[model samples]
Target: MLTHPTLNQLHALGLHGMAKAFVDIQASGDAASLGHAEWLALLLEREASLRHDKRLSARLRYAKLRQQACVEDIDYRTPRGLDRALFAQLAEGSWIDAHANLLICGPAGVGKSWLASALGNKACRDNRTVLYQRVPRLFSELALARGDGRHQRLLRALGRVDLLILDDWGLEPLDAAARHDLLEILEDRYGRRSTIVTSQLPVDQWHALIGDPTYADAVLDRLVHNAHRLELSGESLRRVRAQQAARTA
Candidate 1:
């Protein structure tokens, strides 16, 4: 049956819209016909390529990307003084193997979230498990967890992802229990999994956001070590876009 020539076989191979007439002629099935074997070969090749494309498409959709998000679309190279080589190195899976984390710090609208989300997208595409959470929303979930007595289970779910992306950090001050939860998540995942954190504030000010000196110090101590840190400096990309629009008008 695999040796027989058929239009369905050719369509399966890759000539996406081959007319039924062509297939009907091919499927006539004369035993000595070389056309059948040729068509079969073509179909086999097309099937392989289509399978590859399907796999790639599945990976992209499984990424669960936010709107207008992707690392490839991010203008990292356009950002002045940003290290492309370092970004490439991190993009490779080896950085995680080395137990290193990534910190994407910059002013608002400077592509910090774009970059972090891009990396998370990459991890997902690589078939590694990932989770994305905004700090405020995640903390709110944690607050609910505490009320429902499922805080530890929730934290464990977070800790288990191969990569975790925490976006918009320092947006709100942490109270004692939230601080403890954050620290515990970091410590538990520390050296076991990797994290990508995006924040508008400087690392020096993280102490201020966490609010408890002792706990903040402990948190910083674990995060800063064995981490690949990138500090971005530039005007807001949104403001730049608006200015360009006005100029065009």
Candidate 2:
């Protein structure tokens, strides 16, 4: 019989407390111990940690990205007038090294979100850290954190993420404090990590949406200074899909 070490010994070896439950079940030879379902459950439980691993999420978000969300899936071979060089940069993973921001600016339905999300998913897959949040959601979380006296903690947490995606930036106007908080977050992460922002409004009008010129300038300076600007100038891929479906019908 294999001798079982005390839980303290496991802890000394850096095993998580949750590992005790698995050990207990295994020792007792419970219904779950030797079953495939139980094995899968244990695997999934371990994966729960990935949700909090920002670096891992960032990499997986990129590596395991869905094909539909990728720019490579779109045909640049045709004379559709898409920016080929930008696509090449994205494909080459240059942004991953430069720690530069990615600005996806274009009209709605032009696959801006798809491309940004794909990149984010790719980052997650590559074992880098990443988080995805809409502009409104991010502001709301920060506001709640501030109200709860955890604003600094929240900012620090955002700073530590390897890649942060702020999607739908122009969906709503930002107030003074919210705009300021955004600026701080951007400045903190400036050249330290990467950020991918998808916006319908052009960079020039970002100040108008931010609602404060000085803060907006400071924010844009950090964001645009070391960023990869990809203007997704194409018709809505959704529209194209619909048209193809109709033609098939």
Candidate 3:
């Protein structure tokens, strides 16, 4: 067999994975023992794996998650009131498929943002599109978009993602423009896509934070209903870790 010619053809066809697999198999001592069918199957499998990895890489890059967290790395032993069973179910991503929302509420340093990022990471792994944005920054960007006439285009992009993660919600009360923009984004995504929100404030206070009775009701109606809640309460993890380091030193 003309190995170099075969390799050239594979490379020309952009089958990089298959070409690499072919080289590896050629180097193996048992290459002659495999049947033709087995060799073809191995090449196809490598090609599929390579494509999957490329797709996942693109999804993660687009997500721009706030934290590099994964569900597998979650600290269940931290006593932060994270429900293992519920999170495990959520990790399976059925809720995302159903277009439901997830609310992670806790005080500062209780891993609210981290948990939301972990879920976003999981969604990317599940082959779902995701976008992460801090609430304050998102509003600022939206305001800028409005001024530059990119407002509707930006909102449409936000709405199209499979999972939109809003981290650090309720950092401050929303002004009129922010309130209206938020409603627009949520309304666009209301029944078509899932959202994960992380907040230092509890859900009940969200209405007040939104600031207008009419907009508040409309926003909450889209977000709070059909949402799963994770209420975490504990001492700050940062404080605990620093104390442990001090004791070790």
Clashing pairs in 3: none
Candidate 1, residues 114-196, lDDT tens digits: the string is 77777877776676777788889889899899989899899998888788888899988998888999999999888899888
Cα RMSD of all models vs. native, in order, equals: 5.5, 7.8, 1.0
Each candidate structure's count of clashing pairs: 2, 24, 0
Candidate 3, TM-score vs. the true structure?
0.97
Leading candidate by TM-score: 3
Evaluated against the true structure, the overall lDDT of model 3 is 0.94
Q: Which is the winner by TM-score between candidate 2 and candidate 3?
A: 3
- Candidate 3 lDDT, tens digit per residue, 67-156? 999999998999899999999999999999899999999989989988999999999999999999999999999989988999989999
Q: Which stretches of candidate 3 lie above 4 Å from their native place?
A: none
Cα lDDT tens digits for candidate 2, 92-156: 66676677888888888876766776776655555666667778878898888887889999888
Per-candidate TM-scores read: 0.75, 0.69, 0.97
Compared with the true structure, the alpha-carbon lDDT of candidate 2 equals 0.72
lDDT head-to-head 1 vs 3, winner: 3
Q: Report lDDT per candidate.
A: 0.77, 0.72, 0.94
